[model samples]
Target: MSTLIGKTALVTGASRGIGRAIAARLAAEGALVAVHYGSNKAAADETVAAIQAAGGRAFAVGADFGTEGDIDALLTGLDAGLGGTGLDILVNNAALAGGTDLENSTPDYFDRMFAVNVKAPFFLIQRLLPNMRDGGRVINVSSGVTRIALPETVYAMTKGAVETMSRNLANSYATGKRGITVNTVAPGPVDTGHPMFQIPEVVEGTAKATALDRMGEPEDIAAAVAFLASDDARWITGNTVDATGGMFLGPRF
Candidate 1:
């Protein structure tokens, strides 16, 4: 079960929800994990504690992704935590979720969304590439909204950009010389702690939209991500794996 033994992984936004699940899953496979958080140090610590309690190794790293010098801050903390080891897996999972239609979206909100969801991952990867091992894996958490109509236009746009980045990066590294893999996992209607889950009607509607007849849980998406991060996925890259429970499976009749 220790598929990732002697490896290291960094998962952003590991304070809670999907990010936390991914971190825990990777650590379970014996990866020494760096659990990144924005401002929720307590939650990040809790994540690390849980991993440790399970006989896994993990540590908390803090960085506000959208802010200036964020990549530098993250790398600094990561370097201190890793001591001298290079990274084997990097999961870009931090993002801002709220966005409205064009008419309702403000310039500030759009900018912030792109900054956190798009710009941060771009720079984080750019900076981390040097430290990532030759056979490393880079996984971006994307949204299924990119493939379907969604009211959150700006959020979908950000995920679209991430998918594009993943494709280009994967192609760029496809030579097999370095063997690094870049990919995206797009999840639909995940039952995270987001406020949208507060409404019973919305939850019911979301469940109905999926072929599985149930909304996805954080672990569901994490399972897909875990598979992609493993050696079995060595040949897969530059693609979006739909972890959406067959959401939007067919045209509405």
Candidate 2:
């Protein structure tokens, strides 16, 4: 279980949902985790406390994405938490989702979506590259919307950009020289305690739409992330590990 002992990780958006689960899982694996939150100190603290309560090491770091000085703030907090240690894993799991369909999508909305989902992660990797040790892991959390036709056009586009960024990084000279592995994890309709998941119809429909005949959970996605962060996935890079429970894998006849 201590596959990551002596390693350090930073999971963005670790305040709740999939990010929180990923943070906890990394900590459980014996990694010193820095739980990053976007303007939610209370939730971040709760995540850190849960990890500590589980006999894992974790600390909270806050930086609201898509704003000025966000990366600087994040680096400051992350550096403080690491205490001179280099990072081994960086999970770009934070994003702004939902309500970006064609009719509702505005210029501002589209720009912001790209800003948070694409630009932030790109720059983060750039800035954090120096602080990350060789053979480090960079797992970008993307959505299956890149493959599935979804109403959230803008949102999907942003994720598409993320996938591209990940692949490029995986093959880039920087990562190649440092032995860093970059990959993406795409989840399909995971139940992250959103209100929509509370509706029986929504749950049933989503479950039936998947080949697994069940709805996906945040933990499901987190498990995949943990694997990629581990040394076992050292040879796996420039790939999208689908954590969607076989969603939309043809009609179940």
Could you estimate the TM-score for every candidate?
0.95, 0.98
Model 2 lDDT per residue over 1-253, tens place:
9999999999999999999999999999999999999988999999999999999999999998999999999999999989999999999999998666799888999888888999999999999998799999999999989999989899998999999999999999999888899999999988889999999999999999888888998899999999999999999999999888888889677
Candidate 1 lDDT, tens digit per residue, 114-196? 99999999988888887688889999999999998878899999999999999998888432459999999998888888788
Note the Cα lDDT for every prediction shown.
Answer: 0.91, 0.93
Q: How many clashing residue pairs, candidate 2?
A: 0
Q: Cα-based RMSD of the predictions, in order? A: 1.6, 0.8
What's model 1's overall lDDT? 0.91
Which residue ranges in model 2 land beyond 4 Å of their true spot? none
Deviation in angstroms for 123 in model 2?
0.3
* Residue 216 shift from truth in candidate 2, angstroms: 0.7
Error of 2 at 127 (Å): 0.3
